[model samples]
Target: MTSQSVTPASAPASAEPKVNWTILLLGFAGMVIGQFMAILDIQIVASSLPQIQAGVGASADEISWIQTAYLIPEVVMIPLSGYLSRLWGTQKVFLLSCSGFILMSVAVGLSGSVEQMIFFRAVQGFVGGAMIPTVFAVAFTAFPPAQRVTASVIMGLIVTLAPTIGPTLGGHLTEQMSWRWLFFINVPPGMLVLFLVSRYANFDKGDPSLSKGFDWFGLVLMATFLMSLQFVLEEGAKNDWFADDEILLLSVVTLVTGPLFIWRTLTYYNPIVELRAFANRNFFVGVVMTFTVGLALFGGTFLLPLFLGRVRGYSAAEVGTTMVVSGLAMFATGPFAGRLVRLVDPRVLMFGGFMMCAWGMWDAHAVTDQWGFWEFAGVQALRGVGVMIAMIASQQVTMSTLPPHMVKNASGLVNLFRNVGGAVGLALLNTSLTTNTALHMSELTQNIQNTNAGMQGMLAAMQERFADSVDPAGAAMKAINGMLLKQATTLAFGDAFAMLAIGCAFAAFVTLLAKPVKQQPGAPPVASDAH
Candidate 1:
């Protein structure tokens, strides 16, 4: 299906308008807060799920839905937000979303049962999800090009830093207070955002007339397609992918609805999403770069904590504390990256960023069972700095190159790519870890025979250590098997890191292919082509 180009009702302002820096900055800051809260919620409950599960009296299997419920609806709302924001103006949509999110946060915190928790969490996700892309749209449209670099830096920091620190903050909050504090924490800040944005964010007016030809059927198709696809990705690894009945069903649903949604979107008079922005080559490449960034960003965050908890047996707080090194590195590097993007070619910065990510992942590829905070510190720092730099450059290229009217729609699409990339990366990495660990176990068992001299000596040593036991030989054998399993799992982790390293290295090379973007103080965006 071919997409038609969308023409804006009005062009960009020819001259700079009188600016109110204080009000504008305050409103923008509020929007950033809303964005941070939304993104942070995605990962905050991850480490503390067990507490939530116990509190709600949910089974182990049912407990996962606490997160799945939130994610499915959140993904559905992200792309749809472009249409909503256009129909109801940024200020109104943002205020509504913020208000709904705050109320849902309270409902989720007060939920006493599993069912109640899931229902409220889904509502929270839908509202909170809108805040994310809306900020991206505002950053480009609200700020003049001269100040865009600084704006991008603040955004890059929030986008990366929130998820990076989510587990740490959640673990501490849950430990000191209770799991409910996780949701309640958003209250004060959310209210502040609501007040500030309502007062000062007058970026654009709503086109209520656009509501006339609104495609309700197209909206259904999109929601179904995105929700089904997100469900499949989130649950696929746990259920053994297509082998599970529910996974198979959702996969089919996603396949059927995805094309139908695209066809409807392309053919509709006023489509819900704007696919024409993709016709611009720079935006397309920029989206691809952001996709890779999501893969590394979310993938690394998921992998390291699992490693620490499963292999190293670190407590939640300990794992969180150890992970803070990366967040700190990102915080320290934000200003430098912001300044650097203005001086150097953005493509160059992206290349360097991806390379740094590769170096970090490769360093982790050599991980051992004894590896701890100090061991992972350098690796985490590299990943933190790399993701921040690449993200800032990618964000600039993706949105800055689009025409002013298209930025809203394009922002949603770009953010969606990064999220989907992270989902895909997690599924693939999970599958790889499981398969490789079993393969390594099988190989190790065959290589060490009972008759081998080394095996005999190790068994004898274990037997001597367990001499007081009633069945010393049996205990020795069990200990040997446990050691073998630990070694096998450790090897599998190294393999996972190796996969990430290889992926990042390839992405680094791909970064060079993107066209260079240059921002002028008072001029419109300069793109290679925009129809």
Candidate 2:
């Protein structure tokens, strides 16, 4: 059967660029699989860090660089995608990225040393990062305005649900198979997508000769800024922030280089990145919304595994199973969210999504040490609903308003904020977890004095239980302190959840600031009247 042709949204229908829907579907297949690989890889590694570290005999400090190395290049490449796409064509850049990603994945899997693993992972990140924004460009350019919502819904599911389900899937893989399988797992799908992309995708063509005028200085500044910023966030918690000379220096570098990169991008004729996408009111609001989405997504994602694995003594796979409810929720609501965008103001969807997420975070706020999988299922599911709604709405709210020519740059910007937000949010939340746990520990320890009758009774009870030990009193105190520490940490987890709830609630209010897009029945989207 011949493929159905789609007209580019930017052009008049009579003079529209003809694109085959069969080819488009094939291309989208490539995009979706690519995105899933990129997002899922992050979570999979997170779920099985201990095994991975031991497999390579990496120290705890050294193991962190595995993640950090990936993130730095990933963030740096994200903003540069627009320029690269225009310079090398989306197809070539994407194809090159996929090819590089697959090779790096293979190398990473085969790596027997920490050095090799970090090197390959960083290269993988550089290539893999470009795949994400390229998918968005294809969606906007390949589909007409009428079908953009449908495209957004699909992107929304991949964006929101992949990380949600990553731990569960990663846990299962690590428990049932080798840690190397985590990297190897991307091979089949990545290869299939690679084939589909090379065979079917042809739009967004570029001239490689344009690289001659590329802003090398701006590139240097942006890379330094992103790398330094990533180092600060990733190492900040372990290094105790400014107390570490390395982190302090990186922070200073980030502060100095960030503005210069922005200044260069804004002033240069042929910049490495385009920052003007933020000038659009709708895109600006969308960036804010995307940032919050990332913050909540990553913060909540990190918190659950910590709570389940540490506090409840659950295995990685079990934690993943517990979190799968959120994934299921996203899958269920994603179609509805896609349909809703075409019928109502997108801001409404954003509001509903943010509020739902807030509700989930608030519901899970009072988490206790004794809480089980079922206790969190409802709250996790609620988060799924929120993410689906907000993600889909924000995609429409942001992308639909921008001219088709600007979609690529806009996508790069949107994903950039999402990533940066995740990094910053996870850092802040982790810091809070450590700080609050310590503070709570201090308070709880002070109340354990034997002056109180209850404390005396507990101590006596513990002593009796350990009467056969060499130092029963010391043993009893040790056991009590361990229990207190666990309790303190659980309370700290609760505090983190509560803070996320407040953040989501604030994001919900921020939804009102978005320029709403209303599509009347059988009519195109109407421009915003909101100031």
Candidate 3:
């Protein structure tokens, strides 16, 4: 295999480039596994919370942290993935990451305490983070530009499957089995990915031609900033926002470290992310879209499972089953949608995607305690189609414009937005959830008459459960508390759906801002690399 070099645009008009589907599929397998492992872990855990709480005897705070710990590192590690992929070859780093992730998953399964489990989960996310951008970088590189849309489609399908399948699988494990299986299940697939990647993908000492120097300061500071920000977002809702000293500390670190990180990259010749890559108008615009996409995509994904379980009284497995069709829909649609972008302009497709997402949110907003399950399945399936259109199209557009050399850094920043959007959206939506829940509960609890049929029914049940030992006042308070919790959950889901719709609208506005694809090949790009 001779190394072919091009100046970094589309393949040179004169160069008859070859496509390698075999290598690309091999790489995709690794990525699909990694994505499935990391995200499925999240969804599975969401449904298994009740079982986990029971088995570990974990407190609510501990349970929340179990999720938060994994989430923070998941986003933070995304930016680092590019740097690490470059420092280590993309294939090398990806394989090592899968290996590390599997080990961590095993450890998480073995964890006996809440603290230990959260710690191991975070470690798992940290390793799993490398899978995406590195996978895309490799996919885009190995497969010719003609096949990029196809690769993007496959990528979207595989990535979305984790969240789509996770809930049902999680529900089954938690209900029929134990929550620990959610983490343990990754072990088999992870091993397979690790083995196949090692056998199939080859990594040359990456760009060994580069000077041994890079701006170490920028990398360290940036990681600190992103990691800090992730911590704040993940913990902020439970920590009472600005009131907690830990949040304040993390805020100060993020505020201070972020600027310093930017300055270091700008001032130094070598930076962790080639700061120049962001200089591409198309790439920068892509990153912006990713940020918003992350917010809505991950935000909605996180909120739904939680709301269904907490507010609507759906068992984890039941809720998970509703979303199972979603993965299938995405898998079915991703490649075709990617190819469709070639025929239709991306902006039109992207705008359509956002509109579809908004429509789905509107559909989702109508969820109720008594809502039928199929309605949700339809909502999720429709949402999955919309996400595919936007994601695959944007990836094609973003990759089309950058110099091949800059793809890794650009991919990293793009992945970062994907993660941060989810984390920040989680914080924002959860905040809304907490506040709205309170107000809804207050409004619903008004004018409660002790003799009212509903009240009488609840109080009577409470009285019987406690027998004559139950104080009338205590039983009434308990019933009211349960009612308030139920009402609040309903209100919170409504707020989340509304917020997602608005956010998708904003995403549509931003999509219109993307510049047309330059389609230049074999020429150095004008934008500065983000390194």
Candidate 4:
């Protein structure tokens, strides 16, 4: 069945039909389930990596590939999804991707070797990646323009919260059951989404004739650039950037292919990706803002869990619970935020969102081993407000200005930018944390001289406190050293938060540059139109 296309702004006033809530709800449900599964898959595996390594007999280096395998293909295929959907149909592609993702999850769970797992993971990434952009594309068409902001708010929450919650679920399952359950757990949700989609989804069938003009050169270049870049970013922190030959090689490949891909995109007729989306003023600024949203979202998600699990001695379940407050805060404020998007200048929301994030991250600067749920929950709540405001506002402002015809390809671009930001931001945070830890440790160690009376006295006191230990001196020294490292890591995390705050500030300021989109006042709310 061919999907209905949205009515462009230029359409006659009487051309629109009344809103159809039933189809819209069904579509929204399917999209949320599909999108949630796609996002949660990544973080779930991340949390359960150690257990997975033991199950698959993977070494440290081999374990890294499990994530890399999924990420590279996921990033590479995201932009291409638009073209694929256009060649077939959105509903057809979405259903196909869901089936592939479920089957791949089963394969990954059953695989006896690392090689098999990686292969299946890459396939899963390629298939699942398309679902994200497709669902995003559909959101605009599924809801009327009047209710678009509300729909976006709900979508943004699912997008932002899934990864945050995935770790907690993964932790619970891995600790209580086999690691393979991580994959098996998708079965029930997947089945339900598949049923909803098959029963409710009907999009316009795309013109297969357009497939003949597909830009093969552009596709190859785009794929190469994305894959190489993903490898470089994911492995760079681990390999110490260009110091490693493998990283250096991939960096060179990325540097060369990235420009070629851009050139091909701009020059080719009917390019795989619609590069023209960048030319729109609001879209350009919105893409920049979206980047910050990704950086803050992904970066904070990484930092909070790392700090809790490693420094504060929180288990996976505990970390997940701590982060859940952010999700709850977003849910509580979502409808209000949506209403604000409709009434106020979205730029105001954008600025407020970033400021809220800055406030939360800065507040978290004082975190120590003694800090617990009460401390983190409050800070997360503030940041969750930032997430809802910034994400929903940015999404609405970005796509609203574009003509309806551009939304499909532009949807892919939107998700592409966010993923790129998350990947790059994560790499930066990881590298900074490692380097700052060493610097702080070195500076702190200088104060622990044996010649200092204060240092010696502190050591003696520590030894006395732990008198039960066989080697009191060694035990005291070890305890002192551990405390020092923890303090250093805490400082490093604080520094990361500061950097994120600075970035958010810049994104907020950039929002001022975007011109407001003028919607026709008193336009009747209508269901998304069929082509």
- The 0-to-1 C-alpha lDDT of every candidate, in the order given, reads 0.88, 0.85, 0.75, 0.83
Report each candidate's C-alpha RMSD, comma-separated, in the order given.
6.1, 4.0, 5.7, 4.1
| Cα lDDT tens digits for candidate 1, 1-531 | 001123233633544555677888999999999999998998888788888988999998889888888888988788989988999999999999999999999999999999999999999999888999999898888887767778889999998999889989988899999999999999999999999999988788889988998999999999999999888888898889989999999899999999999899889999889989998888998999999998999889889988998899887788889889999999999988987776788888888999999899999988999999999999999999999999998887777778988999999998898888888888888888899889989989998864788889999999999999999999999999998888899899999998998888898888887887866655323231121
Q: Weakest 10 consecutive residues, lDDT, candidate 1?
A: 1-10
Q: Which candidate's TM-score is highest?
A: 2
Cα TM-score of candidate 4: 0.93
Record all residue pairs in model 4 with backbone atoms less than 3 Å apart, i.e. clashing. Answer: 2-203, 2-204, 2-205, 3-203, 3-204, 4-530
lDDT of residue 175 for candidate 4: 82
lDDT of 2: 0.85
Instruction: Answer with 1 or 4, whichever has the higher TM-score.
Output: 1
How do the residues 118-211 of candidate 4 rate in per-residue lDDT, one tens digit apiece?
Answer: 9999999989898888877787765666667667877888888887677777878888898899988888898888888877776547779878
Model 2 ranges with Cα > 4 A deviation: 1-19, 518-531
lDDT per residue for candidate 2 within 328-438, as digits (tens), equals 999999887776776778898899899999999998879999988899988988988998899999888887777777888788989989988899888889899999999
Worst 10 residues of 3 by lDDT: 522-531
Query: In model 1, which residue pairs have backbone atoms overlapping below 3 Å?
Result: none
- Give the Å shift of residue 359 in candidate 2: 0.8
Cα lDDT for residue 470, model 4?
Answer: 93
**What is candidate 3's lDDT per residue for 459-491, written digit by digit as tens?**
677777766663866866786688677867886
